[model samples]
Target: METMNVQEHWQNMALDQVPLALAGHEVPWVREARLAAFERFAARGFPTRRDEAWKYTDLSILAKRASFAPDNIPPDAPSEAALNAWMLSRQNVHLMVFVNGHYSPELSYPRNLGPGVQLESLAGMLDENAQLPPELFDAVHEHTVLDALNTAFTTDGAVLRLAPGTRLKTPVYLLYIASGYGVSIYPRNIILAGEGAEATVIEHYMGTLDAHNFTDAVTQLELASGVTIDHCKLVQEGSAAFHIAGVHARQKAGSRFVSHSFALGGKLVRNDITSSLDGPDCDCRMNGLYLLNGRQQADHHTCIDHQAPRGTSRECYRGVLDGASRGVFDGKVIVRPGAEKTDAHQSNRNLLLSRQAEVDTKPQLEIYADEVKCTHGATVGQLDEDSLFYMQSRGIDAETARSLLVYGFLNDVIERVPVSELRSRIVDMVLDRLPQGESIKELL
Candidate 1:
């Protein structure tokens, strides 16, 4: 396949959005960071199949035609009914909503976030001319091109800061919705949790059924010693949407970070997740599930670095591919030298439901420490024919039996979700993707 050069097109798009981007009350450092990142993106352009990190995915279609930059503010906020229909099953929490990459105060309800807790819109703070910290712009210097692209055009995102020893009774939710066709959006979120702080944060991205939008988002979390954060990212975009997102986190000594990702819809989607255990006695967990059908494509890339002694990490990801869809998983675990007493494990399992469906899975472990215990593996297989035959012999229909087997394969990952209601919703979505899955609903 031949590829087209898209650097000039993306650069031109960046140039067109320059005024609208700077029109916000951006600080000197932010302005400088944006400029530097734009320069990097202009030089690097979009990643191609040649790049090692992006070998399994292609961006030529995205680059051939430039997408429009959405308005800084939504033309109209979604109605209350729309909000209720799209919100999470667990609604007793602090919520902040963004429409088309811009903050929507009319639909947000983040009052009374408890003492030592600060939850607000990042775009609002900038608009109020508040001087933000330098680390906020630090991600603008990311090594990846998509991340740099996000920093160059970021308009609005959520910011959550937890002071020392603060623990919220409920979770904090950031909801992003896309409905504008041919529009490109960038959302940047930051979470800073001080020592001994605890919280649950969920970032939900929703797209209408007929949307043809493009979204590029980046989230960064900085956890102090003794802090525990449970983070969940839910993506249910339109079937024709293009979504690219990354979650990068850094944890100090005695800190714990758990992340759950669910990818249910998109024409083309990619998720990049990285966790750096920078201190001893830290714990990290990465769990994900993806379902694809038709001609959709989904890819997941994860990196866990144990930089200190006595660190532990576990990663488990599963994917279900149907029809002519494709799935990719590349997970890397690094145990740096002097990071002794580290225990790490990673696994990727994929299931193909049709002959045309495909998967590429790679689990990598790089260890520089002699006293570390590291393991990595991946498996790609189809439904068990013998098991199906046995079920058929037991008076079970073929389609229903296949659906039951897939449900069983993904049951463990669903069990890992801590939230009861959320897990049930995830199960429902999972069933929707399986053939005749609804027929076996009552049996489960």
Candidate 2:
């Protein structure tokens, strides 16, 4: 009898899912993509600590974990009453629900999108033989094994399209609920906005406390000239879950794109965001905040490419680490040779709340255009004792004052969120994690 090593185990896992993946996806090109991705993943396996991009994060435990593929999760959707706690307080938004990576139409709310708007699930479109993009899975970088796995085993996700001059009045909510432990979820979302199109999308991932699942998600977005899109990703997975997600956006001339990431809970998490400014006057803004306590860990990596003249990009990311948790931020900006007049700025700041907590922050700039203006900086520090003392002297208790300052540190990023209702929801979530948070509710 031969014992399979960790790498061999993962490769066999992907190999075993080949029949299921190819059987479910009927499109010729899609089937080819799945096989290609599966082969790549089976050959390379997961990234190791030596890989520069993944050097800071250790994924050794993933090899030892046993999990069921997306197709293996039972198709039973939970009752409406069981989802009350997970529903957003905002009642006017359009909704799409997924249970263990399978779309659930019965749980999804009905909505009337205006003319020139189309919304459909990935599975539904495939079943109906919809004309999908040949490059559906080609928009983002598939350098990591996590991405390869997602493409190989993606069960279901959302697809949104907006014709030229269309404007969506309400946000589209893509809620992914994890209910089965030892289950792996791969969700793939696609958004296409034509010229002068405008919309907002919210991607929320939540799960039960007992769920020890593995989630690998990816989203691809395309914006035409004069288009504007706002995207926010919220993660509240179980404490024992391992989650990895990526967002890739391509922008044309005069297009504006903004992204907000709020990472609140997970055993281990990683986020990757990349934006390509392919046309002049394109604008990209990214904001993120992560709060990690206990032994949790979260890593964020972002890149902005200025491929044309007059492109603009701005990024700000902050993290708060408590207990023995760890945080990492790596941001990069690149200006091509002809990308003159480009303006780019990036900043990463982290706060440590315990002696054992740690953070690794890096902000990088690679410029080939001489006329571009680019700047990047990173900071890692603890709470300012002086500021805390001043607040305590002003009749605020130590605990309340500390909580206020922590909230204040994150307020700037919260203020950048344009959706008011979502902003309030984020505030409430943050407050719940702070000590004596109820006492400072009035102050907010």
Candidate 3:
């Protein structure tokens, strides 16, 4: 397949909004960073469907079109009534709100909490910690072009750090609300947990307006010895949103990292998750659930690399596809040559509701170590016809029966989520959006 050059197109693409630097008087460092990122993006360009990793999802639609910049501030802060109407309300959580790519401290809640827990913005962290992580620019050499693309163009996101011996009872909510007005925005994030520290972090993405936006998000996680990090991510952007997210985790000896990803929005969404067990006795678990409807598309690609001995990793991801939506899952586990006694288990399953709904799943395992145990598998199908029929025979209508079966199928994974409030919230949202009418059978 021949690839077309999109740099010229991007350059000529008329943008309504420009960066803060170009929009007005600029900060030196901000201008420098923006210029550098633009050059990098120009050099690499967008990935085509021919690209092995992007074979199923194409960027042609994005490359050819000119998008508005991350500009536009709402006339007023979201009213309390408006916030109440939102699905994932920020009333309880320690919330941080971002409009476009800029932090809106006025809309954000107070960051009041116990010692050792720091909830701050990425810009602040970059200002204080001059030493940037090496992974920011060079981590993707191992594989994939999405990481490089995100790093090259990312603007602002959140920074979460848990100090040594600190335990956070409340989950930290990092909320990104995009009001692109038909523009594109990139969000970059970094999270760190010190030795023996424990915390549960919730990363939420929601849109307040209808925008043909593109979000290239990246999250880098570093865990020290004996630390436990529970990371929960929910992507519920608007229907017009295009989201590409990457999550990378590096774990030290005796540290445990648990991650759960929920994908429920965006026209085109992809999640690339990678975990490296670089220390012995490390344990990591990766779980994901994506429910797509209409013309939505969701892709999840994961890699678990065991670089040390006596490490264990487990992964399980389930997807629900309805209408003309599509879903993809590619999971790979690699055990290095010297990594002995490694145990890894993985599985991917999908449920399709409509005839047009489709899913493609691939689970791969590469082991060079003789002493490792690993397993992986994938399944794609619809609601069990027999189960639906059985329920329908018991006075349940077809739609109600289907909804019940779908809920039952997804409930197993929902139950595994660590946060009770968050889990319940997600469950209610999914149930509310189900295709069944007001039949008691579906509710049951």
* Candidate achieving the largest lDDT: 2
Per-prediction RMSD in angstroms?
2.4, 2.4, 3.3
lDDT of 1 by residue, 1-444 (tens): 222234566555566346246424356666777776666666777788999999989987876555545456565666778878878743577888888888888788886887999887877776675645766566533747888777777888988899999997688888898866677878989899999999988888888856678899998899999999988988889988889998988999999999888888889889999889999999999999888999999989989989999999999999889999999898999999979999998988999988999999989999999888888888899989999999999999998889988988888788887766667778888887787878767666
What does candidate 2's lDDT look like per residue over 1-444, in tens digits?
122354467556555455345324667777777777766666666778877999989887875566546655465676777676666643777889988888888888738887999988987776566877857665245636787778877887999999999999799988898886678888988999999999999998987765678899988899999999999998888998888988889999999999999998888889888899999999999999999999999999988989999999999999999999999998989898999999999999999999999998888899999788888888999899999999999998999889998999988898898778778778888888999887777666
Best by TM-score: 2
* Candidate 2 residue pairs that clash: none
Candidate 3: tens digits of C-alpha lDDT, residues 10-122? 55653211333342114445445445555555555677776788888877787655553444444345566765565345556777776666677887874576788777777
Model 2 vs. true fold: TM: 0.95
Q: In angstroms, how far off is 357's CA in candidate 3?
A: 1.4
**Global Cα lDDT for candidate 3:** 0.76
TM-score for all predictions?
0.94, 0.95, 0.89
Clashing pairs in 3: none
Candidate 2 regions with alpha-carbon error over 4 angstroms: 1-11, 14-16, 22-24
Better of 2 and 3 by lDDT: 2
Q: How many backbone clashes does candidate 2 have?
A: 0
C-alpha-based local distance difference test score of model 1? 0.83
